[model samples]
Target: MNADRARGAGAVRSPSTATFLSFLWPGLGQWYLGRNRLALVYGLPVVAVALAALWQLNGGLADLAIQLFAPSFSLTVLVLIVLLGVWRLISMADAFTAAPLRTKSSRRPTTLFAVLALLAVIGHAAAGFYAWSFYQAGSKMFVAGLGGDFNSVAPGASGSGTSGDLVAKPGATPATADSRINILLTGVDSSVGRNHALNDTIIVASVDPKSRHVVMLSFPRDIAGFPLWNGGTFSGKINSLMTYAGLHKDQFPDGPLPSLIKELGYLLGVPIHYYAAVDLDGFRTLIDKVGGIDINNPRAIDDPDYGGWTDGRPLGFSLSAGVHHLDGQSALAYARSRKGNGDNDFTRARRQQQLLVALARKLTDPSMLTRLPDLLAAASQTVRTNFPADRLSEMLSLSRQVKDDAIQKYVLGPPYALRSTDATTYSLKLDLAKLSALSIKLFGADSRYAANAPASPSKSP
Candidate 1:
């Protein structure tokens, strides 16, 4: 107490002590001011979350934030930070001017403030723990890879010092840094609401470690090609194979992806070893989490009934020819759009390939490294495959080695594919001969492919 309070019958107290307490801790000043309940509510969560975050930076909580399915709290943090600063300022002001507080024990609820403080700590700690766990899981997923092996005649030589029976090729082999590997990246529309598995995009990616080349083979969704998978032929476009296999996932435990890859291998005459399938929902979310991409999407005509104009309403989608940066929704439209001005499914496939190229290019930019964790996490959520973590690293290296324009896209439509004039339309036939040669040249010789059929030219859409 000040001298004024000591000598006089009634004296006002200085608020400096209250200000000091508030400065030391957000709610401490409020507590000293006799607002115990409010102090607890403000102080505890901040301390707990801060401590927990420091402890588990790479655990479940991080994973949750980074995953495509999880919510992003960056904006939330920014807002909370602003509130914290303002709250501190208010506490300091109230403390400086308020009377030296001395409340009777009966005047305030002690237990409630303590309880609130404890609860805040627990809640924030739990959030931190979850974030840590999320980051841990997400990191693992980020480094994961997909792979495939085929019944091929082992190459003539072994890799360096032989550990066992290893195959060697003239230039590089699939296992070697110099060899080549071909994989199919498929985007399937198989959400719960859709009630169907539609192959939205098909891309054949060839990775050549020797020449440091990455090539793309694109297949259109609507091209009239009889589906070829499981060593059998079905009606309609190649994109419809997933629906057929969805009904049979139980019969074939490995999933329709492998079967579909095998069929595409037959169509392209390439030794397809690995495949990756991603859902559109996760893909979009993934893009959103990373702040989006800039892809030049161009078009001329606007189609009112593009993609069958769902529910008899036009898609209201139109774009004049130009370059632009895209957010999640825009990127999704860029990848899925093939209605008004594009050149059918083959053209659409090429456009999809363009998006992939753009992503690959942007991934290496220095500005993107900060978002790497989130990017990989999103990719893992959207994608599933047999490729391993090491192979993914190799791919990163491959991306750096190859330039954008160097990656040539192979499309299946008119020449390598033929129209089947059966009672049921939409039957496109593969000219096995040309595909066989191209496959061998790109992927090397595999018994499964064996350069089958008569030589023919590739079809163009």
Candidate 2:
């Protein structure tokens, strides 16, 4: 009888101890109970999952976190997280069952097991929520079929057509499939009182993936008297092109934004593969989300007539020359203010570029992990892009390899564009000859003008 009682005591101890061990790690309790084969079955899968996660994080956590903004990847992670939680729970239960049963009534062991299970559930639920948030943000930011052929639909086509209906027209340059990638970045000025959104900022970022070199071309909003893709000339400010095209869809069949993108690509003599349009208000919000940005002001800015578009008030902006930390409102003013002494669209474009680099640097910092949720939310509201989400990881990796010195910035002002008053209002007339030469210098064989000129090898400056 004593021997049986001793065995019963040992059995009761095994259940409580083994259950606690499994709670710490899947299959740990089975290992403790000498179930070696069963332990490997439970533990090896967990180990494999962990290893796979590390492998996928090849660019580190910062890059992986950014990749979550890809809807497909985020959704996959969500499913994996649920499966991982279930696997953990099953491992714990299996461990408890493999242990000897208790003879006496004891509540402590059951209570401990229940508490651990609750924690596992809560942890997985939180992870799933974050994954879902990323998926939602990506869906809002990346528009499907927005990267279609530039001049697919004919002028005067039905406005009811969708982006997917766009097909490449003959002789149209197919989106570049070589070492170079070109993306058009535009900042739209939109607010409650405005009837149309004006693309106040238009910049084309051309990157050479192999060389890790980037060229930024900034087109002034005042650029007018320029040739359009349809063999017509535009007399109004380039900033108003999108709105103009939308209202005159009979003349621009592919809709407003696409029309503007196509025109710019034609002008630049390169195939612009993607576009990202950011609302000015959303730009401010994004800057704030990153805790603002630091910029080196080469000259002082004091705009007396500055109507604070970001602040929604009449607060003018003033800043001294030198390094300065700016909040969202101030950064917007710095990028948008043209009424200041010696300030014009050209200078504003330069400042905008400075802000862009600063923001990119801030976002890639590891410290951004804590602020990711808010950042993603701001991005969803503030920006729209046709850039492929699946390629985000590749871009993120490439961005890290690119250094500041390898980036060349150009503003199509002064020598590149002559100020003309021939029109009713002052405008900038594009010097196409000069621009074509510049294009050939930058893009080499990729430039449309390359057929006539000897293609010069593009070198990093």
Candidate 3:
């Protein structure tokens, strides 16, 4: 054979050794072959991409991985995933096929490859288990925490019937073109120094499955005299329903929350499919976990009882007009504050709805990955809901499909509900006709009270 042909066909190092080494570190095999320049070429880009991801995710590569599932950033995530896959493949191929000048490798290729393969399999299995456990933990926490006083009934209510008995009749359908799902989101402060956690924040999120449209309807806490289930009226402020049910227990057999759910359905003329109650105290932890939230403060807010540290002033918390980034405490104060201009129970209700939307946007951000564990922990402790675990995938899918601009917001105060003084105290006297019209327009039909709904509202709420 010719000298050139002999050189080309010379003996090389173990292909298995090179493949294992490259698998360990993208270019380690090339470096072992004394191909420093080639190693840099194969490794640097991968390292750079990894570093960039870490920086953007606030040192959380796992968060970036999770974010890949989010619809908004799927394209970018797909590209990065493809690039990484191609790089790994190229590195492995180059390492395995590279001609080695030496007769043998220092380490036993078979043993080394076996060890690496075993470790990889074990690590992958452990990771899968951990992810599943984490999801289960979060799911259980959410379900248990959000479920309202399950056995409690409000005063004057008879604990005779269960919620299953009161809900829309089986197989009942919507009155409009699309089906709508309404979820009641309640926020309460039942922490230290508070006598009872009255649900100060009451919101009904109406989701249209077909159009992917959403309408958030805020209910003021002061609305009273709404008829309750099991006969009699829900006395006192509307927000006090949960507390009353909890205290009575006898009146609300299915729980105090179900009473409010039924009442809300009656008031709005819409079927409330599910309910979630979150303790406001954990609001700060949740906000901090997502690296805080941004809100456009149209006017200055100054509250004396805003809870802890007010920049050396007796006033507990103060946020100036304009856009502000709020940590958990500040955000909580902003949402809880009823001292600013346009800041009443009504306005506070609207702010609470706005805060939810803002927080949702913040949680979807990539930087939220590192804090996701903490956020879920806080939620597990703070949130209580009747939303079933089986419907989680559906919720995620609906959330992804819902567009921002398609959302319609309504505060059941002011023009729709006039603040008035009843015989005992103040309450929002709702214009039932107007309110029903608005609900139909924003929520798009109701299966429960199809005949009661009026014409659409002249303008958006």
Candidate 4:
């Protein structure tokens, strides 16, 4: 239209109804003010997101982590509704009172940019909300097998887990006492290595949720003549037992792990109900993820003759006395190092116990609560578990059961452990009968390691 026609269009009265309309529905006011471009600026994304939300509401994510993505998606739309309302009200007021709409569209790019910018901003919020919800959903929904809330395993009860272990309040008591839950925590030295290759570390960890008692006992790596998965006996490191199970799957049928579990169960006289296995590398990563640990040892130690790593790496670790902090990789080195005279495999076991204790102290600190998202994010990505996804809260709450001072550590060597003087190739002495008695006491039918008593564990069976 010509300038004269544009001028004669109207007296250009202020759009009293425009802001109200925008306030009512955003794009509606823009459309009423004769700005098709402005109306669509708010209209398109609003329509797109509304459609997306409707589509998602139909149950597309039942088996996967659906809730993780949904809530955040809703929040994004909410933000858009607010922002578009503000922009449409301001722009439509300009179109109403200023003129019959500018004949020239020189400002079109700026308007276009504003609309696109709003979309870009809202889209970012949507992505962030989705990511955060993903982890929150994961931490809430994910469950490691032994984590309490194993209720599904049992018919009526919630099952004996951390959730069931909660002590009655000061005046109230639980409906019933919790039953015991047993787990076999095993570490096999099976990676590519020399010396005592394959099956290296083995332990039985038992928990009595009702009594809040716990037991942990380590089996000597070189406990000769221990029963094997096959219908025979083997004469090497106990750690080798796991390797045998892994390598000779056919001979030991129930997989190699079952035989090892069976023998430990036999010793403890309790059925093993759960299992957790982590490689040497994963142990280090986990420690690092938790922001390291602190261990106090007065004596300075130095021994470089570690055999696990090919180059000059620490199967052996040396430390200048006093308390020190460790990230995951360093912690792993400390736990696995067998160097100084006081730092043999026995010392390594003690170190592992120490590391665990330090980790317990800070795991649930207020500082850690913030870090939980990042730490758990890393964990869910790298770790694998048979744990149900819905019981994570129960496990996190139950983690409080273990205290720094209450953790127990044990070793088998020297006086308590008898190494055959005749057998001279790095073999620990095995005391099957005494060891069994001790095993019964530690992880037995009752204690869940929730005790305040601290004990050092040892064995050569």
Best-performing candidate as measured by TM-score: 2
Q: Which portions of model 4 show Cα errors greater than 4 Å?
A: 1-177, 187-200, 228-231, 307-316, 369-382, 412-417, 421-424, 443-461
User: What lDDT is reached at residue 421 by model 3?
Assistant: 63
Which scores higher on lDDT, 2 or 4? 2
Best by lDDT: 2
lDDT of 1 by residue, 1-461 (tens): 64323422344333555555665667776666566666677578667756755553443332323331222343344345455555655656555545444444322333443444454446545544444444443333332222211111011111111111212111122565565687778786765567666778888787766667677887766545443534345655667665555466554333444446656665665556555666676767777776777776556535454442223434655556678777666677667766665446666676688887776676556566466556656765666554443344446546776876667777866676666666475556766665555655545444234435346423321
Query: Of the candidates numbered 1 and 3, which has the greater TM-score value?
Result: 3
lDDT against true structure, model 3: 0.64
Ordered by lDDT, highest first, the candidates read 2, 3, 1, 4
* Candidate 4 RMSD to the correct structure: 11.8
**Residues 144-191, candidate 2, lDDT per residue (tens digit)?**
544323222211111222332222121133354336888888887776
Report clash pairs, candidate 2.
none
Model 2 misses residue 313 by how many Å?
A: 6.8
Query: Which regions of candidate 2 deviate over 4 angstroms?
Result: 1-13, 147-178, 309-314, 454-461
CA displacement after TM-score superposition, residue 241 of candidate 3 (Å): 0.5
lDDT per prediction?
Answer: 0.55, 0.78, 0.64, 0.50
What's the TM for model 3?
Answer: 0.68
Q: How would you encode candidate 3's per-residue C-alpha lDDT over 1-461 as one tens digit per residue?
A: 64434433555556686777777767877766556777898889879977876775772454444433333344454455555555666776687667453554344355555565555546545444434434544443334222344322111112222435554321123454345677888787666677766776889897877878788888887877666646787767788877777677787655566667777876777677666666677676777777788898877777766554333436566778898888887887778888655577766776787789898777656566556556656665665555554445455556766777888777888788886666566687777677766655554445344455445333422
Ranking by TM-score: 2, 3, 4, 1
Cα shift from native, residue 461, model 4 (Å): 23
Total backbone clashes of model 4? Answer: 32
In model 2, the Cα lDDT at residue 255 comes to 67
